[model samples]
Target: MATTNFDCIVVGSGNAGSCAALAAKDSGCSRVLILDKCPPDWVGGNGYFTAGAHRTVHGGLADLLPIVRNVSPGSDLASTIDMDPYTAEDFTGDIMRLGGGRSDPGLVKTLVENSRDAVQWLHDRVRTPFTFSFNRQAYLVDGRQKFWGGMVLSTDNGGKGVIDAHQKALNEAGVEIWFDTPAIEFILEEEAIVGVVARRDGQAVRLAAPAVVLASGGYESSREMRGKYLGPGWERAKVRGTPYNTGDGLALARSVGAKLTGDFAGCHSTCWDFDAAADTGDRLLSNQYTKSGYPLGLMVNSNGLRFVDEGEDFRNYTYAKFGREIMNQPGGCAWQVWDSKTTSWLRDEEYGDGVVRKVWANTLEELAETLAEDGLQDKAQFLDTIHTYNLAVDAFVQQHPTTKWDPAVKDDLSTHSLPLPKSNWALPITSPPFLAVKVTCGITFTFGGLAIDPDTAGVLSEETGKPITGLFCTGELVGGLFYGNYPGGSGLTAGAVFGIKAGREAAKLARRL
Candidate 1:
């Protein structure tokens, strides 16, 4: 086998590994090798699928307080706001609450404190172009309305833009990038990561290094892994992002005594239609709510009954709702119902590359028939449910105003006021065609993986409960840091923060070694 050597070997050139490698080079590491399973064209990993939102305890998070105030001002705004004046402490609390008490509090603190500086470093030192707005929030870019205190992002050139900018900086910093090279396994000795075994050019090569960084991303693409770890129901969910994240690095790390945490991953639930399209190869595209300006309608299970509030954070509730449907409902598929007005609004917004336009039929019966033909739902049951729901909606609308249809407030609207099938029959079942779309839970990225120290970004030992020597992890692999829930814009922020910390700290260790 061919062999090589480096001061540091960073596996997977996505946001975390790329940032780590670049930071290592900047910190004076002489030889840093960054290995990616796919070529640069496919190097984005989950970062590409992101809306490029970055929330911080800095002015950005503070700015959102006003927006929250505008929406619901009467409550204990401070408690609901989840912000503290101490930027670091506030961020730590934010992460801890989101992590559901399983996160490494130390690591959470470190990430929160350094996130702002790390983001700024990427912007100023690396010259990556990012805009701040309400959609973009603090470090976020590409937000639409200014009503919210968010940020915006624009691509530097015609390239994939964000990843390209980071790649350019890495290249300028002289980080050695090996593409189409998958790290098959790690070479560990005496509990320290020594090097990596990779496949490059149809040949196996052993590359020796003092430290190894596993940034290969989470295991969303591996159906087998998901079945084993995320349960059987998850296997049916739609994978909306990179299909290349097969969890190779995690497996390799596990073989070397690394402990796993946060195996329950979360995804953006808005891509529900894509989840149903998994077998058909029809990808679900996002930018729906933001791009289309239409409110997400109610979601019903196989029995044609509404479950949770439609406005719940799409990321947190999508998979949970899916699990509930599979366990409680028949056929294991959910139906999304909307009227002509909502359909027209969404169609004009260009949902899912205009597939929503084609999905919507003229009448409720026709909509059910089309769905049955598409193999998305059962025809007879779906039709019956639609008729029943229409009657309920009509009756409810007659008793209440438009605002009464809101799912956020319950007592404010009577049960009769809720828009059921009876509410308004303007575009009733009598209408030649109605609109229905089959939706399944779609995953964005797996949240759980290896645990790491928040302060140093070092992989923590499961047995000893301490940072592992010469091993660092970042991005999705660092579990417990995010807990069960995610704060908006924290994915990229966490990756950048921990990657920088890991790189700099690893460089310091290398110098001492």
Candidate 2:
């Protein structure tokens, strides 16, 4: 404990914590320290497992070309692309709408307003490897690269690349990060946080800091917490990120009388590979375990029924909540079936050569039989569901011959006369060589967390209904931005936004102290 003091101490060394630490240093904090409960391998925490999809408001392709390394303006490739400008209204509306109007307006506004700036800051200041998410966002349709869904940016090499950039930036900033050190509690003096008590090398060490930022992720990793808060059967959902994000910071903050907010029973979940690890995410595979191709086809549960409107919206908007619907099925799992015409469109990262065990057959009957072996309990009903779905598509196309099937946008190529009609991009399953992939729910992060002041990112007090002096929070730890559902890519954007705010404010508080 030679220098047992710092201007600011950040708990958790994930994307949010790293962002806060960098912002603190850049904002004039001389000594900033980061503490993580995980070992060195989990350096970036859940950020290490992210797909690095960064959703931000931008002026379409022209605005993004400067920060991205994938494509350049005036190129032949650029001429073949179609990208629509995304405004703050689009971003704000998406979060509030998807979250069922439960997201805090102040927090959502703060997040949406600063989103583009945060992306630019990440590129310019952190030297993050930015690239157009062509593989995930855009698709080639008739020699045109059309971008859909409002998300267009991702780090090269996904989460690994994002974390690598943070590591380099942290090293340059000289921020000392202590791995395998878990913050057990905060030192509160006269009802204001003054320091942190953490277990370092199996010893209790007290580190002095006028401001402490809690960015230690959420309770998604703890099966107990999941079962307790997120309702029944969530404990069985596959963990899509770091195992260390077990609500440690939430507990630490609550121990000091922090107010909890957001929908405790809700979370960001998705269709994960059925065969994926149940307890933790695979570092090597990372977000590849996600099976989001359901938006391109149809999904049937164990009873062999189409449970959701696959084309309810862009995959980005609907994927998070669909996982919970899958869990609600009879067996708590489902199968995504696509035909030869659309199977090729599935991203290589998710359904390519060896991403997961895939079932293939030249006929629908054989496909159903194959899936039955893997968990399709009602093969006869599965065949009937496909038959009825194909009939509806044929009827719709016959009535509206002008409509074209385009995956890049919601072209309204829908099904007709069905109890649960697919809204758009609906095509007949007539192509041979069908494919089916089994999937289960993958929990990303718990939405429940500490209530924070939207302006300064300070943790709010439960008793006083005010900001706790010298105590701040960011990332998944500081919630109230999401509820029943979440907008894809907003997680990282929200984290960076509040992380920067927390850092700057905490640095000011630290200097004053």
Candidate 3:
């Protein structure tokens, strides 16, 4: 029985919801409210569990120098950094190539063209502390910071900093955020959404708003939904983000006859720590549970055989889709093998001390014996795999004697004469103190949800294939942008881009009321 009327209401408190709320407030909505289903502890949604990497277009390092707060162009350290400019064509090619050309061309164009401007908005309006990702995206190759994979900028403290910056902006603009409120259904009048009915403080509350934006994330947290949509054995995959994104937005939109789109059977999954919590992501460790070092080494399943070409591309290009490969392997798990040569180069945040459970031995045979206790099936096979792989590397080096191993580029330091080839960064894992870590599939978000108008972010109707009058959507709830695979760091950018469109249109609708 409290005051429930609002000019506009945004659901979910994740990156997209926060952006929508801020944009709505800035677009002339006097009273904007954000409804979050989870408690205050889960404020930032999946953004809190992310590494805060934002991929965008730029004129190389010179274009990015004005936005980043970490390094100064006049400093000596800046002289050693090598960053290439990423054009709109480059961003679009990554998406279309990874998605197998199934991505909506209209949505892809909108996202690619506006990505840099959206990131700039975050830096200027939202006060996001952008910094060059020296620790994650760059490698200290030849004593110079060489950035690869066309991704350079990330938040200063990763996802925590991103959410903190959004929170600060929202608070400054007087946006009302109601936690522990789960939106149950849209209040439809003659098939047009006029408001939403949510559970607030253990009671059903109707919040009257002319425009309602559903940015409440995906159904990755729902094991039932995952099993139903993503096929069998998907329920066993570990969740890498919040547990509250359980298809509430999809269900609400479905009730209003909204069209569902995108790849229901696919999701953004990665090689996570084998010992990580299965139910939800750890707030403290966050994305540190990621095990992406396989590119610099080799991966063998429990059956003691390599399954994927670990160096098929840069980690950013392959990491999101490789988790499904692990799930298909024996026992739905695998172990990455590295020797003393490349173990020192692994990112300290993911493979560092106290971050993951590591198995080490002085010899490959000893490593196999130790890993056998931890689910490895065959010791002889593991050793044979290593021996054969090392021989292939030697053969490749013999053929190309001048080949230099460089992680910053596709140096073609690859292995030949193998059934499945390691295309690049293939070094012999024959050094002392061999290291291995267990890895499993950890899903970040689902790729299926409501279809929306690309220009206004308005949810489309299922029957007539038109925009639903007062309903808008953003974030993971807006489908058609992705299919089987996604480029790294583009998720956050897409959310911000659509969030701006949804907020401006929702604010216009609220004004009409």
Candidate 4:
């Protein structure tokens, strides 16, 4: 066996690990080696899958109040737990409440207090330009604007985008990078992490470092881990991101007594795919369900029945809802039905064109026939549901004079100013070539792994709940922060915040060592 030495060894080159490396270099730490199982091309992990929304309270809570009020309109900002002062006390309280009281309070406090500085450091020192999406423009949380600006993107021009920028900055600052090297296990002496055993080029290499950072993403790519931790149904769900996130880093950390949290926090929802072969390259490439003000649309199980409300936030309990009603159906999938009106609207809408290409159908019967061909469901049951839905639409429209026949009225995407003519606008599926497309539950990121102190960004002992000397963890590896509920783009915000802290702290420790 061969051995290598460095002041610090950071495993997993996603947002956290990359930022940590950059920070360590900036903190005057030399000889830092950042190892990742995947290359820079896929460095973002699930961050690449994100719409790039960020929630932060850089200013005091008072300044953020207006943003929050604007985001969740008609809702009392002060009544929301996140609206409290952005102090360490209030932030920790908010995390515990959002985590259903299961989160480590100490870690949550650190994350909240340090989050603003982290955002500022990334924007000012690291120069990672953040952007906002039009859809999330007004959304706010805890008095801070959710998204700072349009698509807060990195100025680095390349295939890797922000990930590449972080990596490049680390390299320029003298940090070494090892690609295709997977950290298989940790070297523990007297119950303290001292080094790691890694696999590189089909050989095991023991790398010794006083400090280790595990930023290796979650277990979404591993069917075995997903089944064991998430649930049995997740074994069948489509993994939408990097295939390299097999959770080896997480398993190794846990083996060394690191606590795990939020194992159940993962995005589960119906996503369009032209075929099983179409699973590659941007999972939402074929989504036909348009996002207006709401998830205005219809979802039919293989049996051709509306299973759940499309407006239901898929990030929350939508997957669990589908598991109970749609997963075990005829084809283990579902179909989305829309009409020409929706087709035209989607084309004209901002996020519509990309989703419209997913649907297929020439007529009501033809759409059902096409679904049958795709092996998604029984044509007869699907046709029957369409009939029932049509009758309901007609009756509802007749009862309401100013009504329009659109099945997606419930998810009315129309602006608030343009209220629907009727409360229920059920469009008839009588048009020729009715459109339908196959949809499967897709995962965004895996939310489980090594536990760390949210404040110090240090790896904690699972039993004693104290920091492990010379070891730090951040990003998806830091468990218990999110618990079960994800507050939209908080994943990126959390990673950036903790990554900067971990890097600075690790560098300081290495200097003393």
Task: Give the alpha-carbon lDDT of every model.
Answer: 0.60, 0.90, 0.92, 0.59
lDDT of 3 at 4: 72
User: TM-score of predicted model 1?
Assistant: 0.76
The better candidate by TM-score, 1 or 2, is: 2
Better of 3 and 4 by TM-score: 3
Q: How do the residues 165-257 of candidate 2 rate in per-residue lDDT, one tens digit apiece? A: 999999999999999999997888999999988999999998999899999999999989998998888878999989888998888988999
TM-score result, candidate 3 = 0.99
Runs of candidate 2 exceeding 4 Å displacement:
1-3
Alpha-carbon RMSD to native, per candidate = 7.1, 1.2, 1.0, 7.6
Evaluate candidate 3 by giving its C-alpha RMSD to the native, one decimal: 1.0
List clash counts for every candidate, in order.
43, 0, 0, 19
Q: What is the lDDT of residue 56 in candidate 2?
A: 97
TM-score of each: 0.76, 0.98, 0.99, 0.75
Instruction: Summarize candidate 1's per-residue lDDT along 90-118 as a digit string, tens digits.
Output: 56665666556766666677777787687
| Residue runs of model 1 more than 4 Å from their true location after superposition | 60-99, 132-159, 264-270, 275-295, 313-332, 340-357, 362-366, 375-434
The TM-score between candidate 2 and the true structure equals: 0.98
The local lDDT score (0 to 100) that residue 358 gets in candidate 1 is: 47
Instruction: Put down candidate 4 lDDT per residue, 275-310, tens digits, no spaces.
Output: 443223353431123122213346688676766554
